[model samples]
Target: MGKENSSVLPVLQWLNRVVSEPHYLLHFLTFFSYFVIRCSATHILAPHLIHHLLQREIQTLLVFAVLALIKGVREETWEAFIADALFLAKICIFVLAFTMDRRLAIWYVLVFLVMHMLTQQPPFQGLGTSSKLTPLQLESLLTEGNTTRLWLVEFCASYSSGCIRSSQQFPELSITYSSKILSFGIVDLGLFPNAAEKFGISLSGCMGQLPTYILFDNATEVARFPELDFETTFFHPTVTKGLLSRHFDLDRSLLEYFNVK
Candidate 1:
């Protein structure tokens, strides 16, 4: 449950921001006003059409829910299953309300649209954004006082085959593993001699062993991979992801996601 909470921290933060702001309350009021006006106009213009459309929308929502549930079952993860269940429940509630009262259905959909718009440009955009860190930035991160996060630092040369391969994998994995517990970054030895000096690796001498892995926990260096065969370690995303997962006590499900053998 602690791990789950860590993963969901960004979501909780987002909710807090939304509910805490006066602008969001104004947005809600605007949506409510529009929904009331629209529903009133509809009832005055065509009361008979409301019942007819409600049945059709309910039928469509039901069919979509069934298909989505089937797909979620095939996914075979607790998160997916729970998400599908919640989606079905939401649709059922909407359908029931639409059947009983048309005005409530208008309010529901308009409120949902307003919330979706609110979330389009989230405040915590950096939670999932990944970029290379220079020596100065990396040092700042270490001293930022947030000791709970995990940092994966890669020291690699520009021309190394292993570095090239890992570069392609890191961006995708950074997105896949975006959470409170994990971050990914790269340091190019070719670019920064000063940064390489801290790790005791000269830029000119890094050809034979081009890529090195270092893991940090609580702003302290916890693990450093020894110079290993590039083909078996640095070149493979699964091996890297799996090693980090095991070291940090992450879920085994990530192994399957990263295709770790």
Candidate 2:
């Protein structure tokens, strides 16, 4: 019974997530619509009508995919799965067309558009929006202070999915851990693209590895989240407060930071 309940928990959680989030539900409906449309088209509609509908749907998806590509409708040019919304949707339509029913393509495309617009990407703080930082300002702040100082700086872009996801957590950390020597700040690489060069991060649409968090000891670079392979994302861990705390040994660092002062 306990094992069964444990296995069932994930399904319940997924259902909760689906119901609570409109986008998730829309995606669910898109798939659900596919089955309904497929069954109706295959059984009720004439062969000619089904063929005509399938052809139209396929054509529509192709047109939209081309338009979306040219319009630069995606989040980034990396062509990553989730980050590029319309592109991902394009993939979904194609897969549904081929694997499930070609007639389902345009309906899912419409569903994708609705979900995209409804879940309008709110104005993310991006890299610089949270806290403004000029090169000179950053330089001055990094200099060793009178007390043992540590500055936790997050390098992020507003448009970056990873950056946006972790946006609230960083500020929350600032509220929790900020002190004279211990400080928290953000540099929006989106606003200061050149800053990416100095930090070995890229702002290029294809290569922008965002939300790089660096724990600075005075003027020196002490540590960073995702310290390895900041460029290639074979496996980029989701940036969370718990992950941040563990990576930088935050609790120990805080104790040491306070002990010195």
State every prediction's TM-score relative to the real structure. 0.39, 0.55
- Which regions of candidate 2 deviate over 4 angstroms? 1-104, 107-120, 123-131, 144-148, 204-208, 228-233
The runs of at least 3 residues in candidate 1 whose Cα sits more than 4 Å from the true structure, single-residue gaps closed, are 1-129, 202-208, 227-261
**Per-residue C-alpha lDDT of model 1 across residues 1-261, encoded as one tens digit per residue:** 999998688467645665775434444454355446446756564566666756765686678778777965564333234334445645654664576468876776776666545532211123234557888887788767773266777677655534543444445456776555567777777788677768755354333445666767666887765444555343433225445455444453344335633
Reference-based lDDT, each prediction: 0.56, 0.65
Clashes of 1: 0
Sum up the clashes in candidate 2.
5
CA displacement after TM-score superposition, residue 40 of candidate 1 (Å): 83
Show the lowest summed lDDT stretch of 10 residues, model 2: 74-83
* lDDT per residue (tens digit) for residues 1-261 in model 2: 999998688567656666776656666677566567677658877778677767866876687677667545432212222235435555755565654455555656676677777763322233321345675677788873664378788887766666654566777666667666577778888788888889877654455367788888877898876664745344566666677888888888778768978
C-alpha-based local distance difference test score of model 1: 0.56
